[model samples]
Every structure is written in C-alpha cells, then in structure tokens.
Target: MYRIGVDLGGTNIAVGIVDEKYKIIAQNSTKTKRERGAKAIVKDIALLIEDLLRKTGIKVDEICSAGIGVPGAVDTKKGVVTFSNNFDFKSTELKKMLKDTTGFDFFVANDANAAAFGEYIAGSGKGSDNFVLMTIGTGIGAGIVINGKIYTGVNGAAAEIGHTVIVKDGIPCSCGRKGCFERYASASALTSMAQNAAEENTNSELYKLCGGDIKKIEGRTVFAAIEKNDKTAGEVLDKFIEYLAVGVTNIVNALQPDVLAIGGGVSAAGDVLINPLKQRVQIEDYARFCELKTIIKAAVLSNDAGIIGAAYLDLT
Candidate 1:
C-alpha cells in the first residue's frame, strides 16, 4: 500500500504519494493563502489529496495512511497544532479533520522533526544510527533521531534547540525570550546584521547589491557580496558565522549525534557555510578532545524531506 504525506506551511501546502520504497510517485501543491483561516486551509488540503489520488489513479483503500508535517508545536498524540506563529494557528484539531474527510488514518508532527527523519532515512544521515538536522532559515529549527526513532520528548517539544539561550540578554526572540540562539544564528539575523552594516556604510558593496534597499538584503546577499571581496559583507558574515558556530557547537555538545545534517534556504551557500561551520564546531565543541566528532554536512533532499519524512511517521 502507498502512503500519503503533506508538508503544510504558511505559504503553501505540498502533498505527495509515496510507494512502499519511499519514492514519491506523484505529488501536488497549492498556495495556502493562510488568511482564509484553519477550516478553509484544511478543506484545501483534503481537496489536494483527492486530486493527487485522482490523477495517480490510486484508491483510498490502497493507501497505508496519511501524515502531515506542521511548523508549530504539535500534539502528535492528539493530532493538534498547539500554536504556530507562521500559520497563525492555535490548538487546531487537524488529524480528525483530515481523517473525517479523507478516510485515511492521519498523523501529525513538527515540520523540523519530519525533515530530520527524512534525512536520517534517505538523505545525508542514511547510514547513521544517531542523526540531528538543523534547518537555518527565517528561524533555526532542529530535529533529533536516535536508534532509528525520533526523540520528541515527553511533551513533544524536546528538540527545539533554536529557543535555547546562547547569549544571555543579548538579543530578543519572538518566543518572548531574551538572547535566544535563533535571534543571532538564523538567516533573518544574518540579513539583519548585513542590513546594519550596509546602512552604517553607504559605500559598502552590500548597499549596491541590494540597490540601496535594505529590505532586499536576504541571507544570500552577504555571501554574494563576499564573493566580490566586499569588506562590510565579510564583516557581517564573520559575525554571523561566530553566532552560528555557537549554536552548532551547543547541539554537538548536547546530542553528539553521528550525523548533523544542515538544511533550509541558508544551506544553499553550500561549502561556504558548511566548511566554516565544521571548523567552528571542531574548535568549540566540548568533546574536542574526543577521537570521534559528528560529521556535519548539507541535507541532500532540499524541500522533499518533509514529505518523505511524513510518509514514514507511522513507522517512526
């Protein structure tokens, strides 16, 4: 029997049909248009799933189950999204909604955890017994896998490494905490740092790259400018790397996973981010004296990780 997986996000909903081999044979996508509210989006998700089955000629009875990866604190046992700033969701009962409409057993999990599981099963962590995934996008999200199973903690919010405090009272975080790691190590933080540098110096290459529009300074902006030997961009990247190293090293020290794969939009920088991050972790990790160190690398399955991982949620 095939399995269905949905990657539900604030901007879009991606649904996929995975065969027994974990290959996605068919998929569908749609804009979430989140302003429409939870019920509307849920309707769209059910519709999209139906559309996929129709196009692929797969009957509901041939499906093993369906699962969704949400971006908030999820009550996996209850199938509810407790809260999600991105989707503006609050205690939404998603599993029952889908199950009632689609007639398939539904499962739900945090998006980050699904991605980590996907990587562990088929991507960079394929051969590892212990795996950790860190996605550096607008905010940092992490997932942990040990003994071939996800460790969601007793409360289903265990691996939230982004909210961990790294620099007491240094920067404010959306979680209403001071000095959370994401405030300094996230892609948004990198762009903010680059913006400050460009604004402080009008002649900086950063200013030219963004055409004098600081709002256009994305995470890749600094890296592109650095390729041209831009001084201000280099400075911003150096500081960003330092903050990133702190977070990565902390993850290494705490989990000691066999493979710590990196994912998300910022990971597009490839070696530009991984090489330095590796060096920083090597020097900063508490187990530097140990003979074994976690192998840090990019996640091979970019956006598909969520869908594939969700497909295997039942097994996990």
Candidate 2:
C-alpha cells in the first residue's frame, strides 16, 4: 500500500507518493497562485494527487491514506485550517475536500509540525524521542516531538518557538510582539542586519553585492559576503548567531529535549551557524536545572521533509 502527502506552501505545493517504508516513490510540485482563492487551490491539489498516483501507477485502494500539511493554524481533529497567511484559506475543510475528490482517508497538520515529525522519524532525530525542529527561514517555526509523537498541545497551537521573547524592547516582530526570537534569529533577520550594516559600511563588499541598494540585500548575499571574509558581513553574522543562540538556549533550558534539529535557509550556513549556537547553549542555557546536554544538529531532510512527514501523520 502507498500513501500520499501534500505540502502546501505560499509559492508551491509539493505532492509525493510514499511506500510503507516512508520512501518517496514519486514526487511533483506546482506553483500555488493564492490569488485564485481557496477553492482553486484545493482543486489544484486534487489534480496533482491524481496525476501523481497515475504516474506512479498506484490505485486509490492501494493507498492507505493521504495527509496535508498547511502553513497555518489547523484543527487537526476537525481536519480544518483555522486560518492561513500563505493562502486565502480560512475555516476550510481541507481533509474533507481532499477525501471527497480522491476518495481516500485524509489527515491535516500544521506544516512545521509535519516537518518536525518527518525529521524525527526518518531524518536527523530518527533515534530520539524528544527534540525540537526549528525552521529558520522568512520566519522561525518549531515543532516539538515528545515521546515519539508530535505534541500539538490542547488547541493544536503549541510549540510556537518563534514568539519566545529574546529581548525586552528590541526589534518588532510581525506577531505584534517586540523582540520575538524570529526578529533576530531568522533568515529575514540576517538579511535585514546585512542591509543595515551595508548602509553604515559603504566600503564593505556587501554593498557591492547588493548593487549599492540596501533594499536589495538578501540572506544569500550576506552569506556570500561572509564567504569572501568581509569584516562587516562577518560582524552581522556574528550578531545574528548570538541572537539565535539566545533563543535556542532558552529552549534547551526549558524543554530539555534530547536534540534540537535546525532546518530552513539560514541553517545552510552549516558549521558557521551551528558552532557558535552550541557554544552559547553551553554558556547560558540555565545549565544548573537539567545539566542541558542536548545535542544540536542540522536537519537531514532539507526540502521534502514536510511532504514525507505529512504522509506519515496517519501512522503517528
């Protein structure tokens, strides 16, 4: 028997067919034009699933179930998306729609939670029961896996690690809170830091990389500048890592998870990002409480984690 997973994102929707072993036998993706509205988006997903099953030669009866990971608040038990900023989906019965269209049992979960489960079961945290999967991209999102299961709390909205306060009155976050972890630790934060540094250090290579337009500076541009040993870029990265470590240290001290798996675009910095973060955890993570020896590592399933994890939600 097979299972289908759909990862619906702001720009694209990834669909995959997986075997019982959790290996993706066939995968495909299509652009998500959210302006087309919720109904169109659901239709697109249904079509993609149908096309994928045909391409993989898997019958509907041969599939055990289907799962969808949505980028928003989800009522998992009700199979509804409460609200989503990535698309025009609010109070929509996502699971029922898919089931009606494809005639398969379906499940729905928060995208980050799905990614976390995927990593825990088949990727980096495979052997660990308790860990935090933090995705540091445009925003920071986290999934808490405890006792070999995804913990969504009572309302299915727990593990919002990004909103954890880091500074008293520092940068403002989109969540209407000041000094949220994502404000300083995310890829968007790194890019913003680079742009601010470029403005102050006109002679820095980052200025040239941004074509002298601070507004054009991006996370990759800053990473490239740091690669060339640019002092200003390195300084921005150092500060960025410091804030990231501060938030992570807090998680370590509080949750005492067995591991912290870092994913998303910022994690691409690899050792440069992981090393200092680890050091900070050792130095300031309220170590007296739990002897925080939690291991920190990069996520193994880069892009496909959400799709694969969503597919396995039924098993969980």
Candidate 3:
C-alpha cells in the first residue's frame, strides 16, 4: 500500500506519495495562504492530497494512511494541533478534519519531530537507535529518537532543545525567554551578527555585500565573506560556533545519542561550521561520553526530510 506525507509550513504545503521502501514516488506543493484561516488551510490540505493521489494514478482506497507534520505544538494522542504560530490552528482536530473530508486514516506529528523520525529511519540516523535531529533555521528545533522511536514525553512536547537556556539574560528569543540557544545558534542569529559586524567594520567586504546597509546583511553574506578570508566575518562565525558547541555539548552529555544530525540553512556552511562544533564538543563533553562519541553529521534528506518523515508517522 502507498503512504502519503504532508508538510504544512508557513509559506507552502508539500505533499509526497511514498512506497514501502520510503522512496518518494510522487510529490507536489502549493502556497499556504495562512491568513485565510484554519478551515481554509484544512481545505487546502485536502485538495493537496487529492491532487497528489490523482497525479500518481492511485486509487484512494489503495493508500494505507496519511500523515501530517505541523509546525507547532501537537496533541498526537488526540490527533490535534494544539498551537501553531505559522497557521491559525488552536486545538484543531486535524486528523478528524482530514478523515471526515477524505474518508482515510490520518496521523499528525510536530514538524521537527517528524523530520527527526524520518532521518532516523531513512536518512542520516539510519542503523542508529539513538540520535538527535537539530534543525537550525530562524530558530533551533530538535527531534529526539531513541530505541528506534520518536520520544514524545507524556504531554507530547518533549525535546525542545532550542529553548534550552545557554546564557543568563543574554539574547532575547521569540519564546519570550532570554539566552535561549536559538537566540545565539540559529541562521537568524548568524545573520544578525553579520549585520552588526558590517556596521562596525565599514572596511569589510560584508558591508559592500550588504550595499552598506546593515539591515540587508544575511547569513549567506557572512559565509561568503568568510570564504574570502575576511577577518570580521570569521570572528562572527567563530562566536556563533562557540554558542552552537555549548548547546550541542549539553545534548551529548544529557542523552549521549549515537548521532547528532544537523540540518537547515546554517548547516550549508559545511565543514566551516562542523569542524569548530566538533572541536568544542570534544573538549567540553564528558570524557566518559567520549568513548561512545556521537557522530555529528549533516542531514542527507535536506528539504525532503519533512515530507519523507511525515510519511513514516505510522511507525510512531
């Protein structure tokens, strides 16, 4: 039987059809008009699923189950999205909504958690029972997989590693907490650092890249400057890496997962980012934990992770 995966994001909704081997056989996407309201969004999801099945020439009854990954707090047991900042979904019974509309069994999971499970089963974390999938985007989000399953705590809100405190009263975070790891370790943090550096170092090429407008500087601009061996850019990256290592070290010490799969735009910096993080984790993490050193690697699925992971929610 075929399985369907739906990734609901702020900007777009992606749907994929997968076979038993976890390969995406068919996929499609459409803009998410979240401003339209929750009911409209649910309607859009229904349509997306219909479109995907039609394109794949698969009968509705041939599908085993459909899974949805939403970017917010999820009540997996109740099949509801309790809260979502990207969409106006508050205690919405997503599974029932889709099931009533399509007459198919459906499951829902937190987007990050789903992506982590996807990676664990089909991507980088393959063959490992314990690992963490960290997505470093506008904010940091983590998915914890242990013993070949997603470890959602009693309330289904576990592994919120991003909001873990890194510094006391440091940078402000969207979660209203100060010194959250995301405030310092995400792509947004790097971009903000680059902008501030550009303003201070007028002679730096980053300033030129931003057209002398600090507000226009972004993480990619900083990475480009680092590639050119710009000292100012390198400094910004070094500090960012330090904060990342601090947070990662905590993960290693706490769970000692077999691997830590890093994903998201910031991870695109490649070895320039990985090497420093490795060095710091090696130094700060417990030496006993070093014996079973967690392999730190980039996520292989990239953008496809959410869709692929959503499809495997049945295993959860």
Candidate 4:
C-alpha cells in the first residue's frame, strides 16, 4: 500500500506518495501562495494529492493513512496547527479541512519533528533508539527521539532547543525573546557575522566573495575566506563554531542521547563543520572523558526527510 505525505511550508507544498519501505514513489509540488489564505492553500493541497494519485494510477484503496508536516506548533491530538509564524497561521484546523476537502484523514506534526523521526528511522539515526537532529538554516530547529519515538512532550511541543537562552540579554529573536541559542548558532547567524566581517575587511577574500556587497554574504562566505586564510573570516568562523558548540554541549549534558546528527544547508560544509564541532564539544561537553559519548554525525537525508517521516506519522 501507499501513503501520502505532505510537507506544507511557507514557500511550497510538497506531496509524496510513499510505499511501505518509506520510499517516495511519486511526488508533486506547488507554491504555498500563503497570500491566498489558508483555505486556498488547503484546497490546493487537496488538488495536488488527487493529481499525484491520478498520474500514478493508484486507487484510493491502495493507499493507507496520510500525514502532513506543518512548519509550526501542532496540536496532534486535536489535529490543529496551533501556530505557524512562517505562514502566519494560528489555530488552523488543517487535518479537518483536508478531510473535508479530500475525504482522507491525516496525521500532523511539526515539520522539524517529522524530519527528525525520518532521520531516526531511515537515515543517520537508523541504528540508534535515541537520536537528536539539529538543523541549522535560516534558524535552528531540533528533533529529539527516545526509544524509537519522537519525544514530543505533554502537548506535542517539546524539544524546542533553539529557543533556549545562551547569552543573557543578548540578541533579540523573532520569537520576541533575547539571546536565543538559535540567534547565535544558526547558519543565518553565521551569514550575518560573515557579512559584517566582509564589510569591515575589504582586503579579505570574504569581501571579494561577496563582491564587495555585504548583503551578498552567505553561510559559505566565511568558509571560502577561511580556505584563503583570511584573518577576519577565520575569526568569524571560530566565534560561530564556538557558539554552535555551546548549544550542542548543552544538549549532550541534558539529554545524553545515543547519536546527535546535524542537518540543513549548513551541514553541506561536512567536515568543515563537524571537525571543529568535535573539538569544541570535546572540550566543553560535560563528560569530557566518559566511557561512552554521543556520536555526532551529519544527517544522511538532505531535504526529503520530512516526506518520509510524515508518511510514517501513523507508525505508532
């Protein structure tokens, strides 16, 4: 049998037809067009699913349950999207709307949590029962898995590690908080740091990479400069990596999971990010010389994690 998985994001809505093996056998996508309102978006989602099923020639009976990954807080039991800042959604009854529009029931979860479950079951966390996934992109998102299950707490909103305060009275966060760990450690933070360095150090390779435009600086800017031995870029990278380590060390100290996996575009740096993280975490983690340590690795799945994980939302 097949299952439908929908990853509803601010920019796009991706639909996947996944088989029992967790493979996305068929897929479809469309712009979310949030400006059209949530009702239109939900209608488009239904249309997309029907189109995929028709193209694949899969009858409704051949499909099992469906799941959707929302980029916000979800009330799983209530099947409500409590909040989604990216889409400006609040208390959206996504599951009910889908059922009404398409006559199919679905499970819903936070997109990051779904991806973490996907990684735990089929990617980097495959062999471990307890896993942690840290995705560093425009922001920082974490997914925690324990005993082979997503560790969403009482109201299914646990493991928001990114919001934890790192530096008291530090930078402001979009969440209306100050000194959030994500503000200091996310790839966005790195890019901002790089942009400042590039603007200040015109002679550095980073500035050249950005073509003298500070707005053009990105996560790779500092790394490119570091390769060329640019002093300012190296300094920026060091500070960013140190900030990343501080939060990771906190996770290790708090949860002590079996594996800690990194995900998102920044993870593309691979060893450039991992090697330094290893060193910083080693020196800063609570159990420096423990017999067993959390195995830090990169997530194997790049972007399809949400699809696979969402497809398996009813696995329990």
TM-scores for all candidates? 0.95, 0.95, 0.96, 0.95
Q: lDDT by residue for model 2 over 1-316, one digit each (tens)?
A: 8888888888998999988887989998899887887778778888888899788778888888789888888899999888887777889898888778767778899999999988988898888879789999989999999998888878777788999889999788778899899988888888888999999999999998888999999888887897889999999988988898888888888888888999998787788778878887788867645654789999989888898899999966
After the best TM-score superposition of candidate 3, give how far the Cα of residue 174 lies from its true spot, in angstroms.
2.5
The residue pairs in collision within model 3 are: none
Best by lDDT: 1
For each candidate, the alpha-carbon lDDT, in order, equals 0.89, 0.87, 0.87, 0.88
Q: Per-residue lDDT tens digits of candidate 4, residues 131-213?
A: 99999988899989899878878766778888999999999998888999999999999999888878788998998888788
Better of 2 and 4 by lDDT: 4
The pairs that clash in candidate 4 are none
Backbone clashes under 3 angstroms, per model: 0, 0, 0, 0
- Per-residue CA lDDT of model 3 for 147-215, tens digit only, reads 988887776678889899999999887788999999999999999888888889999988888888898
- List the candidates ranked by lDDT, beginning with the highest: 1, 4, 3, 2
User: What is candidate 4's TM-score against the reference?
Assistant: 0.95
Residue pairs of candidate 2 with colliding backbone atoms: none
Give the RMSD in angstroms, all C-alphas superposed, for model 1: 1.6
lDDT of 1 by residue, 165-263 (tens): 999987878789999999998998998899999999889889999999999998889989989999999889889889988988888888899999989
- Cα lDDT of candidate 4 equals 0.88
